[model samples]
Target: MKRIWNNSWLQKGLRNSTFMQSKSPHQIDPELSDKLFSIVNDILPPDKQVKPRTGLLTFGDAPFHISQPNQHDTKAEFEHEYQIVTEAMAGLRKLVPLFLTREDADQQRTLDLLRLEFDAKMQQGAPETPIDVAIDLVRSVVADVGGLRASVRIFIDLFRALSERRDELEQQRDKFWNLPHRAPEYYARAIANRLAKLYARKTGQKPTSGASTDTGDASTKFTKALEQIFSLLDIQSGARPPADWAIKNLTEEDLAPRMSVLENLGLGPSPSRKGLSMSRCVLPEGPKD
Candidate 1:
């Protein structure tokens, strides 16, 4: 009897031969694979992480059925699948805050896992408090619920609080701002400013600065700087300020320089004394086209 080359046994033999020829070239390390699995495993729900029939060997849609027919390139396929898992993990990381706000058990589980991972990373020399954590919390929470405008407002509120606190502690700077944790605040401030710009682009309005009790020399300087920046933007665009553009309850003193991109938008202090307090911009009749 002649053996068929396309038979299962023959195909397995060919795959085995090919794999043996290059077994050491691109093998996935067991330790690294386990580490990647640990991260991926937490991103998915318990039931979805492992199939009943596969026990704990399967992860999401990627099965560890190494001996299955047509899965000839086992190592490459494994790595590719793991790469996809890592990408999913990255997305899940961003979505963790949303999940934490959810009431589902599966979501809470994923949130706890993410918090643990964040804590572990922090322990490894990363400053993970106040500026980093606080701003991120505001961003994820506000952006999830209130859209770009709300997110911008919440960021300004948080940034202003941090700035005020930092200013108060300036006399004790040797013990506070000098710490490594404060380093992240600088980056977070820059990110908040960028978010302010995004809000301006989305609404064609300057964001409320959320400056806490600014009625001093600092306030004057801030307002002047803000007006200068807004003037520059208007001049550079070669367009006059919108004829009908106007911000409510907000003067240059109440605006942040970074958020002065739109001088016509209106904003007011928060009524609730927490979060961002902002009033909607008043555009002239007939859509802001």
Candidate 2:
């Protein structure tokens, strides 16, 4: 009797890891997992309470993924994840009754039955889910007379049903993923490219038009033009533009094209213009009375 109980415990442990790992803490039905945990915790001995630490179960690892948990931000988070593991174990215990009905099947018999059913499901490409297997066992019991034969037949049928359902879901998932994207996404990308081009044009250095020029002559001409405009406005200014304001290392040939670009942008030396007249001030008259 003791041996049979241990075998049942092993079966539950094996199922616990597989089932809990696939499900997230949110999926752990609050009422169901809590109820299950209460029952299993009461039934099992303290040492027998399986707390899978590493990547073996869902809770200790990432909450909603299959990856390993490298670190936890706080001790509370770490404790919470393990708590989920305990809850999952309870959830798994809820399925045992669907299979083990009679008191006759001893340890070896029960183990063999579960192992065979698990292998049968794997052979048919159904995922190893203990809850699913237990559900299948219930159906198998109903289909045939309750015994070993019925268990075997039920497992085979269960595997086939799971495989068909998995295939159908995969087809639907593929269809949804392959659908065309929205038009606005493409339009947004195009607008972004155009804006980038405008920014580049505004900031990029424009190449000088001609390759060579007499630097001394061009410099003399530009200085004359600059001073002529200054004199016409009667404003005394520095002979050269500030180094910080424009290209300091510009060759005379390069300066000409850049100056032309500035001129086109309405920044070139303004046409030599006479200063405009200021408005004359008028005095207000006091009241005659």
- Give the runs in model 2 whose Cα sits over 4 Å from its true position: 7-147, 180-289
RMSD of 1: 25.9
Best by TM-score: 2
Candidate 2 backbone overlaps, count: 0
Q: Per-residue lDDT for 82-192 in model 1, tens only?
A: 455444434432432242223456765775676555544333322223533333343344434534334334433443444333333342343233455433223223223
Candidate 2 lDDT, 239-263, residue by residue in tens: 2332112233333443232232212
**How big is the positional error of residue 76 in model 2, measured in Å on the Cα after superposition?**
30
The lDDT per prediction is 0.34, 0.34
Instruction: Quote the lDDT for 142 in model 2.
Output: 42
